[model samples]
Target: MMGGKGNSVFSLSPNPNHLCISMEDGSQSSEQLVVDDDDDDLPPIDDTPDLDIDLEEEEEEETRRDEKCFMAPPAPGMEFDSYDDAYSFYNSYARALGFAIRVKSSWTKRNSKEKRGAVLCCNCQGFKLLKDASSRRKDTRTGCQAMIRLRLIQFDRWKVDQVYLHHNHSFDPHRAHKKSSSAATKTTLPQPPLHVQVRTIRLYRTLSLHTPPTHPLFQSSRRLELRGGFRALQDFFFQIQLTSPNFLYLMDLADDGCLRNVFWIDARARAAYSHFGDLLLFDTTCLSNAYDLPLVAFVGINHHGDTILLGCGLVADQSFDTYVWLFRAWLTCMLGRPPQTFITQQCKAMRTAVSEVFPRAHHRLSLTHVLHNIFHSVVQLQDSDLFRMALNRVVYGCLKVEEFEIAWEEMIIRFGLTNNETIQHMFQDRELWAPVYLKDTFLAGALTFPLGNVAAPFIFSGYVHENTSLREFLEGYESFLDQKYTREALCDSESLKSIPELKTTHPYESQMAKVFTMQIFRRFQDEVSAMSSCFGVTQVHSNGSASSYVVKEREGEKVRDFEVIYETSAAAQVRCFCVCGGFSFNGYQCRHVLLLLSHNGLQEVPPQYILQRWRKDVKRLYVAEFGSGRVDIMNPDQWYEHLHRRAMQVVEQGMRSKEHCRAAWEAFKECANKVQFVTEKPS
Candidate 1:
């Protein structure tokens, strides 16, 4: 028997004197196969079991040929209970041998109540590379007629009926058995160790800070691509959605079928925004990611005077339409109640979007961004230091519009920047930037203390410089959020530890110390301490139900005063007009009002004065699930306001002494749960 082409034999010749044995009734006959040729290497006929062997010499030679050539079993004809089993057996054998096998044809008759089926065949080694890169290599079979066929057996079982063992090309079993870098072998990528994954997560975050998302590092980085590309990153989003009920993700595709924009916000962030969103800070200065898309963050000041990241968006452009679309999407998520005040860089697109989406909202420019421009404007001046100091004093010290006008004119004249384009532009947008014009707005002086400059919730300009893929940027975003949460937690812990001693005789101050967080309590303490310096001169109004008082603050260095109007109603709510606009901007009662309240016969802080965002338990987001969609218990801002009212009533009645309404608190909570359950249930 001569082997064909590279020791690959096609047939084995039978000996002339060899006896042909056949099976009868599914059982082999007890017949002996006689060896024809005088081949001493062949096993004796009587030694062989009762089996079909046309020629002993040929059979022995076949076995020797396989061993000599080191050929693995070629796609064995094995019995299987189903097509899947047959494929598994054949593929496993083929894999063990070098080279690949694929199905050429298959048939199935399952609908006819017959268990007849087969699937994929050997396409692995059939295709050849084309001369041209563009040319198709659809069929380049090696004419190796090594095929396996399966037929239906009893009880839905499939039995291998035919398996040919002829190949035109040779194979190396050892090399094929080992894993290969070919795409065919990589059906599933191996997962890295948990520790390695954690370390990679850190590396990904660090690299993201220095490179844009479209950089080569993000595309080819092994550590970042271990999760199997963009699909894996999408899976992460799905996982978040599955685990978190309040998480929302929205994406829009461009005309070329690419991602145009995306916005995501978790439940906690949304809840925080709903409570502290009255004074919003929108910043679009951070342009990051591979697409060079701007990172827009909506930030708000919490009760602690700390910045709270509300939500983030990535847009293709800073156009009015794009900003409008982004704001509308955010509004939909936040239940359509816009923030009362918006602090942002003086971008025309951003300004237009705010005016359209939140017509009632007070759109103010960020003082930080304004000062940035002022510095740039003064950079070319002869005496820049004098100009900067003059600018700061003009912007910071003015408490009235008239004072601001005088200071602004003097600074520009003194510094010879009267014709400056930057200053002129700022003057044109004076109401948007100057605190004097925006003193009535409840922004909590956020313009002075910009929230946009604080801890960013997602990928911001400071954290991303390398070009990165969308998937990698998103993964890095998760890590960034984790870091922010860790920082916030640490800050909260440190603030709690450093809570000042309640060194005041006012009962309301002591009550506030218990209800408010340490940071807010300390802040309110200043007002309590200053109450001693404020002298009230009350005058009865014609209405008779209300009285106006001149609260004059006569400190040794600073002399300031405010008008406090006390409504002589059972509710006991006081209104104050102060230069600082602390109550209007910060959501907390100003010092003058606090002094007036303390001076009055009031026993506790008015419920209306206590903002929920300052409460110790502001993190508890009240989410309610309903059918396919869900709604926040505080979906409508009024709901939160109503809850605050009830809470204040409870606190007012409970804080009569050290022993308050413990039972009443429990009852109120229980009633709230029951009401929520009923309201949330489908009608």
Candidate 2:
């Protein structure tokens, strides 16, 4: 029981459920504290139901705090060694009370550089993107004003200076406040802003794994298309220029400012072409691009019998004018030197362009394309197998002109293809595809590069498909070249190790085994082996100066004849026409010619018979390029000529020994050192 005195004096009993009245003398009575009867300023207790308070829980909490001293946490005004310790203590206290805590403010001493005091506060943070008028301000800021201010009492101990127990906002027990607080404190490094992190994640996740790491993610995520693919091509060409200084890239724009043509050649490709450009396999069949554009690749055979990339082009169309422009661009890039023989698809535009741009070069159609076209045309005919068999024999089996003629005539008559337009056309252009016609040329058996174009029946039979972007396409192309180069290097190393102390039966063969690559050497070895079966039958004179010998290959009762032209002089020149055209097609001497060379007392293979392209050291040949075009004048720049002369002199003087080289190096250093003094003296 409690009693009210005047207006403020009152006392409470020990029972939490009831308020007992008491006098100032501390005596309890069965009476309640009530408002003064005369004071009309106070409302009646029964009328003020909204102002009711829960004092019973507070009294119970205080009683429990006093009873459970060991189990309960330290009471308020507790001391700790550091701010983190104080924060950690309050964090546990706040967790038990069902609320989140946050650092409100902190300060440190200017002189000692020690953290002085920290004010801990309730976490009133909230989200406010919704449109609730009453909840808007509350969502932004709780304004709870409940905090504990801690200060340094002793030098190392911190004491709770002030603790505001009252809060203006209600505690949300269902919210994961502790988890949110821990996540907020986990980051020690500065993280990117929210918007930037969101964008980065979106872009990276949107990109496919097949996309290159260097791809521009921003543009890809935006899903924007380039202006006729010009921007993509420009970026790729610029990157190529940076990575390969010797690379040549040229682009042509149409009247509408769209990319019409593109051509590119790398240093390795140009160097390879400088040696192997004698027989080029020009292929426009394998056009790998998303734009359905014609991407032609110039392929050449290396000594290892592998196709090496010489150059590439993207043309607008397969028209005569477009091909002319492309061919001219390639010619300019290659300094106007065209291949001796051209092998390509049977397209009129390419044929006309080759005749006009490279008139002296022999033009031949790819036998594979011819066979494919023929097969497609005759597949509908009755007894097509017979016709196909005969066609294959005429195209591939016949080794002589007379044999090919007789086989082709029989095939036409037996298949009733004399009236067929495709058969007639093939026969008309037989020389362009027949091996017997081009047998003498050195093609290294490279008829065509089995590449496909997008516009065709999707003949990506080689597993190389079109690319979506210019960079991706170029990357695929470069990777293919890298793989080929590595394979060829490995082959060269293995072949070098496999050679024995004495590699061949004859002196010339032994010398060639050391000079040529394994592939070329093997081809030469076959020719040398065949020489034992070949003999000179008769001799004839051509132009009254060159003597031609009819060499015959005899086996039991059968015999075959070949013409060998021998020019006997201080510099002997030997040539053969065995209908195989092995030397003309492969740059290697045939059996008939080899037999003649042996009979003529030639101790070694003459330098005239050896084309540098087939040699193992072909890549060492120097190929000159003058910007984008050729120059008519030799040593156009006097400074380069002077430098070359000086270099040659130094090289000659230092060729004796390391001592001579060292002396030259020291002299060069002394001369260079005097330049600074000479420049400082002026004029």
Candidate 3:
């Protein structure tokens, strides 16, 4: 018999008794066979299994081929006892066909978070997620449509709802089988070992400072595609959870199983947001990684007037859908509390998303944007800077909503902008973006962006930059948090010990200094200094108890009129409000109201005027579920603060006697040496 692959044919040689088997390789072999009468037919060989053949191996190969029959794609009615069983069935099919599969996504019922169905697809089915220049895997995703859909059926059974087998790229059995790339990575707990775990960690440490962390498969000098690309990302998240269990992350996946957006907030970030979440500022263009994924930072102002990152997300694109996902995820992470007010970071998508997700949320554009648009987007204005400054004054110093409306109309007419679409649009949306119109709400200084000379969030300007990889971005984010938290800790210490000189003889200054933070005290001092701008006050009308005054105030090169109402109806309460809306806009007393109080001989700032949000000794409500700081990963500030108090106590007791002092110093040195030795010791 001729042993070869493919079809074979038999032929007779010159010798009638011999039979020849011709192979496709052009080889001829013969075996003796009995010919029938008249030489018309040959007898078949005796039916027998060859003793030399491995029947078990043959059976296994046959079984594998049978499983590969599913490559025609599983039938829609195919049923399984559980979702895992369903996944395993299709995974086996993919294994036999030589490709990878992953959970594309899971669908949940409307108004619920419970997953109802699962969509699994080829690993390389979706468009490339990251835009890394050196990524070899960029072309791996050929938009393969090979996938399976699993639906939860009656009696808790999972059934195949759909199957697609067409592949855009050629696949073979040798392709790595990544059946459990991301879902199987549950190393959130401390596991002793993974494949080459120690070696990978050592390599990561050596290269991480200079280069971005990459998959172990891509650690070579030459770029290589990741095997189970998202496995590493998921592992990274778990590793952080190992240190900080309160690290909240939500990922949005494409239909083809690609990660589209990711949002994260740590325990500390949650605590900060609870205090500062009233006003959120998000900028999508803030920072980017090596892959060019847009880093969206949700930031807020701390009591120190420093910008703090409240939450962060990496979006595939700044499209409407992506922003909607970001907003929803952040809202969920913050426990469904929408920000009272927000200023978007010059992206229209953000604004649109905020409106869609949090429709009730009051959104406003920064004064900077309105001015910038007039100066750049509009060109008809002859004195753009002059007009901008004039508009800025009216918005800032105007006492009533009517005053702003009149001033805006006057500017349009003066600039011959009656037909200008820009001015007309601004007028149409005045109630939406105008600060004077939004004075009744609490903003907590949301309006002071570029105007306040506030510094940018530390993460964007200092920690991360262009060309940062996912690994590097995370590391930089951690470093960013560390630096900011450290600064705040230090500032807290300084504020506790340092005292500011009195800017005024009024007792209100002393009261503010005692409760307000040093930064806020300076803001209060600015308002105190502006009291001289109050020209005079004339009584408008008095009902023997309620009195109103029309006051003149100096603003730049002009004098503006403001009305302040003082109601002394009840001796227990002296109700007052200035139409300037400074207190409501900025959470502090306006200069106009302060001027009136000063003239009335009132010495102390009202208790309501001092906001708890800006109080120097504001208490923090920490949700331990948001992470209580595991023993291994204690907060550095807290550690230092507690240790410092103990050390100071030791120093105080030791100073009582020379012998005690020597003993304390010696013990400290010995403890330090031991700690140093333990740190230097290797695992």
Which model scores highest in lDDT?
3
Alpha carbon lDDT at 635, candidate 3: 24
TM-score of each: 0.54, 0.54, 0.58
Residues 1-683, candidate 1, lDDT per residue (tens digit)? Answer: 00011011112211110000111211112222222121122111111111121122475564443222221232212234445444444444454344445445444442333335443334343444454346563343565666665554455455444446556676644333332223233333333321221110010012324556665333221111112233444466556655554465544332111334556676667666656777777767654222333457777776667766677766656555466657776775677778888877787656866777888988888777777777877787789988888888787777778989998998788878888898899999999877778767777646546335432322254565444445566667777777776766665665555555887788878878776778778778877887778775554343566666667788688876566666665654454455656677666777777766767767877887787777775543323211223323422322333354355456545643445677667768998899887755552
Q: Tens-digit lDDT track for model 3 on 543-572?
A: 888889877888789888888988774654
Candidate 3's displacement at residue 85, Å, is 12
Off by over 4 Å in 2: 1-231, 287-293, 381-385, 396-403, 439-463, 466-472, 491-504, 532-559, 570-575, 599-603, 617-624, 627-683
How well does candidate 1 score on lDDT at residue 140? 35
Error of 1 at 181 (Å): 38
Which portions of model 3 miss their true places by more than 4 Å?
A: 1-239, 286-293, 345-352, 379-382, 416-424, 451-459, 462-472, 543-545, 556-558, 568-571, 621-683
Query: Predicted candidate 3: what Cα RMSD to the true structure?
Result: 22.2
What candidate 1 gets wrong by more than 4 Å, as runs, is: 1-239, 288-293, 450-473, 486-500, 532-548, 554-558, 563-572, 600-603, 617-619, 622-683
Q: List the residue pairs that clash in candidate 3.
A: 290-468
RMSD of each: 22.5, 29.9, 22.2
For model 1, the local distance difference test gives 0.54
How do the residues 188-227 of candidate 2 rate in per-residue lDDT, one tens digit apiece? 4343332221110010012234646564321211111232
Write down the lDDT of every candidate, Cα atoms only: 0.54, 0.56, 0.57
